[model samples]
Target chain A: MDAVRPVFYVSDGTGITAETIGHSLLTQFSGSRFQTDRLPFVDTPDRARDAANRIRAAGEAARTRPIVVTSCVDGSLTALVAESGALMLDVFAPFIEPLERELGEARQQRVGQAHGIVDFDTYHRRINAMNYALTHDDGISMNYDEADLILVGVSRAGKTPTCVYLALHHGIRAANYPLTPDDLEEERLPAKLRQHRNKLFGLTIDPIRLHQIRQERRANSRYAQLDTCKREVAQAEAMLRREGIEMLSTTHASIEEISSRVLEHLGINREMY
Target chain B: MDAVRPVFYVSDGTGITAETIGHSLLTQFSGSRFQTDRLPFVDTPDRARDAANRIRAAGEAARTRPIVVTSCVDGSLTALVAESGALMLDVFAPFIEPLERELGEARQQRVGQAHGIVDFDTYHRRINAMNYALTHDDGISMNYDEADLILVGVSRAGKTPTCVYLALHHGIRAANYPLTPDDLEEERLPAKLRQHRNKLFGLTIDPIRLHQIRQERRANSRYAQLDTCKREVAQAEAMLRREGIEMLSTTHASIEEISSRVLEHLGINREMY
Candidate 1:
């Protein structure tokens, strides 16, 4: 096994943007193993010193210069991290100058502004979307009129998480309904779902994968059997085809991917950050 | 305002990974305006042609070449997007060959692998964490034993969304409690919260900011009054200090920032992808 190298994602705010980009970069180096740590809210000189010390200690322990990916808006703090005897990758520094030149204005060097709660309207929209997803999950509420999208799938076909992700990340109101055996038996969409046909998107999965997922939750049950999963997926897919609704398979997709595809398919432009 | 550039996030599967990285890159260019579109699930040659046509149309309409950021693992689809007369930024293509060389294995050219539901364990963990956050929110449940972190703050200090973000993004089981006026009057930590002191993290905000946030939710109410907000914030900060709990201000922080800071302060390592 390759020795794990210490990797730090440092930011003056939440460090999520740094981590997201850093993780993408790290994923490309398949031979390297990384022990990642996030250091967020390092807004002060004192905190910067502490982060530098931590980075130094990590490098010493690993016997190699640690990789520090940072997105600090504060120039002094960015300089401090760069001088910490580590391989520092400043995510923001390289682009800020070019952006300033392009836009003909000075960049805001304020900490946390990039991901801050400065826009309460956007924040409330996200929260309201999340609440909507939670309330309308699993057909618990028949409030399709309020939903920007409605996902239909068999059990464990990745409906709930996708809805949650859509709601939380993009402020899109998503509701999900599980297509149960009862709904599949009739060879037709549920009455409630039929009324919101325009809002409905279907998700189908490979039976083998669906069975494996179901077995984890309910081992040895009839519902977890391969035949049951096969039948359910087939019926659900047929129903979607019959209704002329676009569908996607969740077999090899992440919640992020599923939500994005749904949005694209629905021709809904994502709300800006 | 600057003329808006057409920006396309294109992918063979879900365009989320491309969009995420592209969005981070664009954030640095604060002066430029971008009209963004997501084209997902371009797995087939026909769909790729459609995407290329769309990009061409967008560029022609804007009278400037569109910027295309893509994560299409399929070579043909990627090539098609590149030939679309746009400034192409292939996120996955630049690193795949180097990774294959380093790992001594041929890369899996599977679309959607980057954000697939291959790890059922991680999926379940995230779902479980989300359920935990929902059940334990607002001190509605005293199940702190299962909570990895409990956030305490005055009402509308941005607790619920932070908890939801932590759970959904990082699979962190977070609960939140609102520090009410009743708790502040006693000048002591709530008995239920004191028992779980080790898990507690405080969230504070500028009184004016808190008042503004509260006014949106409960307009013309005592809870939204500036004086009330000032008193509650003062009491909450003092109580957190007295209890020796680590606290962060959400006045200028994003939910991502707040969650990441909370995780960092708690010294909890996030589960890796």
Candidate 2:
């Protein structure tokens, strides 16, 4: 207990979570005697070595055991930890087993619920927004002019996350309208959004991926079927193209990339995260 | 090439960077179709599984290969990747090597710049802060009233990162002042902060850990010696106690712990990340 040592947390990307959790655990150990040196934003290889060397130096100077907690998207710190010869804890490695169990259960549950279902979570959130819009009408009509961007997507397209991410990270206000069967039959943009065609961005995903994402929330539902997901995505993309509004296929892109691409399209020079 | 699937990114934390890079990579693969899912605040094990299950389901539904790009502090998706049998690319793993090299060079260069220079980056940041404070005195004055807490420590203590983390994560503004030898001799708190004694928090680290962190930054300098580090930390702590301010030793605690504990001491509720 008297031989207290320095603890290290090396995060590969954001370093926010690993750092946060490491701090939590270290607090448990130190009670009143804990101390740490956090090195955040080590996204590049040079930065990881810097963190490793810092750990090594810290170890050499310690009269006791030194602990290093690292969080990275890649296993780049393996060598750094091996070289440092300190007590190393990789925060990410421990969660894999738990995640497996949790996912396994989710898979089984979805398989059981495969009939006549609706994605209530998604439904609820969208409904919540509609309710907000309805209540906040304030005679301040839902003008496309007030929207920074309008998202047109088929049901279960990756519109919600992108919208939320855009709003939260860049402060770009976005309104999303699902291209329901009614909208598709009408063969026109959402009536509320036709006025803001210039600000519209479309999101389309691979049918299969959309089905899987949908199934996880409500298994065995018509919405989770591959054919349904596929048809809706294709029709939605076609509609977007027909409307001549810009569209992004989100079948295999990442949120960062989509947001970046969106920002690029919108010509917005803002850091999203 | 025909069998190649579109790329995808799944993030359990902030999905900003993952999406950005994922999109770029998808474009490089010449696959115009890509997908993204941003799952933020995946703190619990169950939430992690839910995220993984969504990925697996997405893969099963895909007509092509499922290339997954993901980042998580808890490694929840490592099992997901292994079980989903997807081609997983951890973007953050490759950075440590480069970081190691840069830090080694820095240690060599800064070996004699200070006494016991642990946490070289931290030292540099603080020095930068001091420099900035010297010039930008009018910018965001961390008010004594609004500060969630204040930190008192000797030079080289881990005050800056802890404060910064608190500010960024919890919106708790933290202010820190170094207890100098002059203040010890005067037997009083720094005159600038006497009025804010109620909000003061103190930080101390073990001399050995302090020495090690210093040596990493300053290699063989006399100031990097354990004894000197100990003396300063002890003297600074003693002065803090004499002023009747409560202190936490950062000897074995992580930053998250320090911030939370400080918040707890101040009777503040910490926001969930």
Candidate 3:
């Protein structure tokens, strides 16, 4: 932990895939500290050599072998990066061999398409969904006809971030309807949302977490009080239970977790673009 | 090509890591088509068996061996999935041994952290950046002191979506300034943006694509006219060039590609949260 190891993600494209895989792998070694770098778009041999040189320089500076994760489809690029005397891990290579054996066809020497614009329709849909998420956020729009999912929760209960995540990541038209004080008092599904009940997903947080989150927005106010939080959470849970809406707590969960569960429950298995 | 192969992404956590790797691999085999499914949170042995059953059922339905990509760190869960007579690809297992060798310590058998809220600060930063992006989008706020990056472009030239992507994906406080006709004619960045010149990045789009995008918003108006698009884009490009601001064309690039390039240009080495 004292000597931070240098890590590099080298790729022919954006290197995002390489970085994501590297980050996930690093998490398992919690005791180790790593200083990471990204050398993206190393398509040409010159760029690949430069990436290798950078890795070697980092190695000389750190006085240890750098760990390199390469997601390059072209084998030559990965080989060049590995020639820098680093512990190179080809994230896609191990899978490619097995995939070839299964399919009985060789994988093509193509660049990774993790972040490219291969599908214009998908691109537009993401942008459109983002626009939809913005306009329909926080009960601003009662029109839930086009929303793929409608997130219902109390104020400061972590609805907006999840909505944004759903739209931006999954291309889902996610509108959030905050269960206002009046709605909670009614103890019934909002009339407009009742029709779109199939699209409704409820989110709740622990009262303490909710209070803390709200306190950040409005300090020392009734809205941020623990009592108010507990009451609203209890009411929201009761209302959701009565309405037969499946829900999850976002207190310990990430936005990705909440959105993934929502998609799973709804049986939306669309590929993330 | 005639038959759509069935593919499954099984993981102890959200299965996002497995799915992401699978998706990128699938892109390499353009000649093959696939029907993909995600089985997230298969932590328990029972859940793992259920996931395996699902994979086997899909194989039976397709009359072809299914491809299973597993990101489970625990050996037991992955073993259960592999027993279903599918070609199982353990995404994490192959890397663990190498990472262990490099660190001179064993990797933990914990779940992947690709989608979990392991870092509270990082999670909150993402949510806060999202809020900031929303509040500061489309010239909504002139404040730039706090912005990590400011995106300026003509209307519908893909600023808002890019900003949202930056916020939601990279936890970047990205604000967009739509270069209006007035600003284009003046041949200078808006006065408010001059102070934050180093933070400024420009986005441009092909005039025809811009025309098409605008037509969807307000059909048959001057705003959607090809001439208007051409003039605005040309002027915006020239002005950005004259102001010594780096720019990229979003016409053919995905939002992820554009955002990655911007972060690279700005030298922001933030790990995507």
Best candidate, lDDT: 3
Q: What does candidate 2's lDDT look like per residue over A46-134, in tens digits?
A: 76677777788877786555667665545555455546766666654543343334223211111101111223333233323333332
- Which pairs of residues clash in candidate 1, taking residues 3 or more apart in a chain or in different chains? A14-B257
TM-score of chain A of 1: 0.95
What global local distance difference test value does model 3 have? 0.86
| Residue pairs that clash (backbone atoms under 3 angstroms), model 3 | none
Off by over 4 Å in 1: A44-46, A73-76, A92-111, A206-234, A271-273, B42-49, B71-82, B89-113, B180-186, B205-235, B271-273
Whole-model alpha-carbon lDDT for candidate 1: 0.80
Q: For residues A135-239, write the lDDT of model 1, one tens digit per residue.
A: 888786878988898999898888888887888788999999999899999889899988888898999998998998889779999999999999999999998
- Residue B206 accuracy (lDDT) in model 2: 75
DockQ (Cα-based) per candidate? 0.37, 0.02, 0.72
Indicate which candidate wins on DockQ: 3
Q: TM-score of candidate 3 restricted to chain B?
A: 0.97
* Model 1: per-residue Cα lDDT at residue B71: 78
